[model samples]
Target chain A: MARVVVDVMPKPEILDPQGKAVTGALQRLGFAGLAVRQGKRFEIEVDGEVTDERLDEIRRAAETLLANTVIETFAVSVETQEQAAAQGQPA
Target chain B: MARVVVDVMPKPEILDPQGKAVTGALQRLGFAGLAVRQGKRFEIEVDGEVTDERLDEIRRAAETLLANTVIETFAVSVETQEQAAAQGQPA
Candidate 1:
């Protein structure tokens, strides 16, 4: 099976209160950083290879239901067990 | 600045209603997929290099504030703007 990962992030202009809360918690926990932005990640497992057409369809799904396009932007990546193993990454 | 991405996913045994809902929506939208797993992604921008120590700190943050370790698992990645540009990937 092919695993497609869609990451939906808020637009830079949009306010991310959840992210802010996390940042606050991080600071309270004594972690230091510039900033934190929270987002959503969807892992879709599909049968067979993820062809160009399949990717296109997944992108459409991302745009329609996986993201709030009005305030968010998304990026897609494909992962497979074989590829993960090749890269020494766990699946 | 460096960008650290933390992906938190539910344990295999846990129920993911959000993911199921999305999968159902996609099928209704005429898109076919095997299954969908929903998760959270945190984008943290930190100043200076992301040293091993810093990564460890981020991992701690992930475990403490970014994930409910009892039912979730998390992975972290570091991204730099220059690296993204070099790879022709959007930052």
Candidate 2:
């Protein structure tokens, strides 16, 4: 099995009200920052090995369903079980 | 400036209906996998240097505002602009 992480974020040009709200909350909480952009993250646990073809399939999934391509972009990363464990997460 | 990524995910014991919906969508779209879990990702660009104190503050932000501790857990990563650029993202 393999674990894949997909991060879906809005285009920088688009306004992110949720992010802006969090930014405001952070400021009220005494943490100053440049900006905050909120997005979606998907952690997929797949059966079998992760091949190049599978990676392409995952990209398609991101483009077609995981993200709204017109206003959002996504990046995909394959994570090893060991790496997930090191991060204190079960894969 | 530094870009910090906070990934907030539901606890394994908690049910993720959104993830289940996405999983069904993916299978319907002809993509096969074991399971899919969805969560939130925050990309925060902060001013000044990223010190340990600042990292703690980010953690606090994550704990207090970014994640609902009762049902979700979050992980934080500090990314350098160079690293973000390498990943083809603007920091």
Candidate 3:
């Protein structure tokens, strides 16, 4: 199975309240000099090889359901075997 | 400034209702043969250079505040200039 990763992040111009709260909490806990923006990550397991058409379909899925295009942007990447192994998954 | 990305994901055996819903939704939408697991991604902008000690500190912070170790796992990595440029950010 091939795994694809889709990351959805708020637009740079958008205000991320969740990220702001975490930043404040971190600062209160003495972790300083850090600014954070929180987003979503989706790991998709595909049944077969990832062809260009499959990737395009995944991109469309990301655009339609995974991200709010007006306020967020999404990026899709296929995970390599090495990456999967690094993450402690069976390669 | 340096950017560090922290990804927190649920343990593989854990139930992911959100992901299940999305998977069902996608299948219903005619995107088939795919399974998805959802997680969180944090983009942290550091004030200065990222030294080893700083990386350790961030790891601690991730353990303490960013991830619930009982049910989730986290990984930290520094974003390269090439990745930033690919993402349409000023490198």
Candidate 4:
């Protein structure tokens, strides 16, 4: 199976209410030096023929539906267990 | 510095409009065997002596502000380069 992960985040200038709330909480918790940002992640699992061609389709889907075209920027990744074991380890 | 990441996803029964849209797109893209879900991720970075006690405070912040106490479940992790390198070396 192939998993496509998409992460979407609001532009730095866009006011993120959720992020602001967390920032305030962090400050209250004595983490005076933390910067927080709220964003979105979507996990899509696909079976049968995981190819670069298929990934392009999913990437387009993320851009059109999973992410807001107006104020958010997104990153897309298509991964498999073998791929994970092959390249740089995930953070 | 330490970073905390919180991921939030709707309950299975909850209507995920973003997810639904992605599902539709995937189906159209010929990924008939795939299931898609949409969710949120928040990244927080803090400076000034990180400790176990500080981590507890951040966990609470994630529960309170980073996640909706109602329908979403979240996972928290504290990681650093040294830890990653140690883990990667495979003892």
Candidate 5:
């Protein structure tokens, strides 16, 4: 099995209603000293070996659907259980 | 420091354009036996002790902004390096 971690963020220029809300609440909740950025992740478990080329194709698919290329940016990475373990995460 | 993981998923009935696209790609990529769902995550690092109550406040803030209580759903958890490591992740 393979793990794919993807993050899709709103176009920087576009207004993120949710992000705005969180920022506001942080200020009210005594977390005014910090700033917050919002994004998303999709943890997918796919069967079979994920070749680098195949992974790139998946990233493209995510970029096209999960993000607005016009303004938003996104990234995807594929790794195996051993790789994940080496990174200090559970296999 | 705190690392908060949040997942904001579109309402079940709402069409997930991103999720759909991924599904198509997975099938095309020879992952025909699988299904896909897409969601977002927020990783926030805040200084100071994260008391349980403070964490709740943060979750509420996230819900109001990052999640659509009406149609979408989300979940948030707070943990220290010790807890995270206990769960098998490097804190």
Candidate 6:
């Protein structure tokens, strides 16, 4: 199976309270000089080969359902076998 | 500035209701043969160069704060310039 990854992140202009809270917590915990932004990751396992057409479909899905276009943006990419192995996932 | 990416995913055996809901929604929307698991992504911007020690520190931060070790697994990686450009993020 091919795995597709869709990442949905808040727009640069948007304020991310969750990220801000984490940043503050990290500083309080003595981890400094770091700025964080939080987002969502979706791993979709497809039953067949990932073709360009399939990628397009996934992209459309990302745009339509995975991301809030008004305040967020999404990127879709296919997870390679090497990456799967590195993550200790079955390839 | 250097960017580090931390991805936190639910344990394989854990129930992912959000992902399951998304999967059902996709099927209802005519997108088929896809199973999804949802997770969290954190983008951290470091003020200085990323050294091995810094990476270890980030890993610690991820383990202590970014992920719930009981039910989530996290991976930390540096975001290369190429990937930033591809994602339309400032490098």
Candidate 2: which stretches are off by over 4 Å? A87-91, B86-91
Tell me what fraction of the real C-alpha contacts between chains A and B each candidate also makes.
0.66, 0.63, 0.62, 0.60, 0.26, 0.61
Candidate 3 lDDT for residue A67 = 89
lDDT, residue A13, model 1: 88
Clashing pairs in 4: none
Ranked by DockQ, the better of candidates 5 and 6 is: 6
Q: Write the per-residue lDDT of candidate 3 for residues A4-48, one digit (tens) a residue.
A: 999888989999999999999999999999999999989999999
Error of 5 at A35 (Å): 2.3
Comparison by TM-score, 3 against 4, better one: 3
Q: Encode model 4's per-residue lDDT on B9-90: one tens digit a residue.
A: 6766677887887788768765566688788887767777667777777667767666675766666666576643332221
Q: Which stretches of candidate 6 lie over 4 Å from their true place?
A: A89-91, B89-91
Docking class of 4: acceptable
Task: Note the DockQ of each predicted structure.
Answer: 0.53, 0.55, 0.55, 0.30, 0.17, 0.55
Model 1 docking category: medium
Model 4 lDDT tens row, A1-91: 6777776877667888988887887687755667888888787777777688777776677666676757777777666676433322112
Model 1 alpha-carbon drift over 4 Å, by segment: A82-91, B82-91
lDDT, candidate 5, B1-91, per-residue tens: 6765555666557777877777787677655533466777664555566677666766776665666677666666554686434322111
Q: How far is A23's C-alpha from truth in model 3 (Å)?
A: 0.4
- Model 6 — TM-score against the truth? 0.95
TM-score of chain A of each: 0.86, 0.90, 0.94, 0.80, 0.75, 0.92
User: Which one wins on TM-score?
Assistant: 3
Interface RMSD of each: 4.2, 3.8, 4.0, 9.4, 8.8, 3.9
What docking tier does model 6 reach?
A: medium
Candidate 6 per-residue C-alpha lDDT over B1-91 given as tens digits, one digit per residue, 9 for 90 to 100: 9999999999899999999999999999888988999999999999899999899999999989999888988888899988866665311
Candidate 5 residue spans exceeding 4 A from truth = A79-91, B1-34, B43-91
**Top candidate, metric lDDT:** 3
DockQ of 5: 0.17
Error of 6 at B81 (Å): 1.4
Residue-level lDDT of model 2, residues A18-86, one tens digit each, is 999999998988887647999998999989998998888888888888988788878888998775775
State in Å the error of residue B42, model 2. Answer: 0.4
CA shift of A27, model 2, Å:
1.1
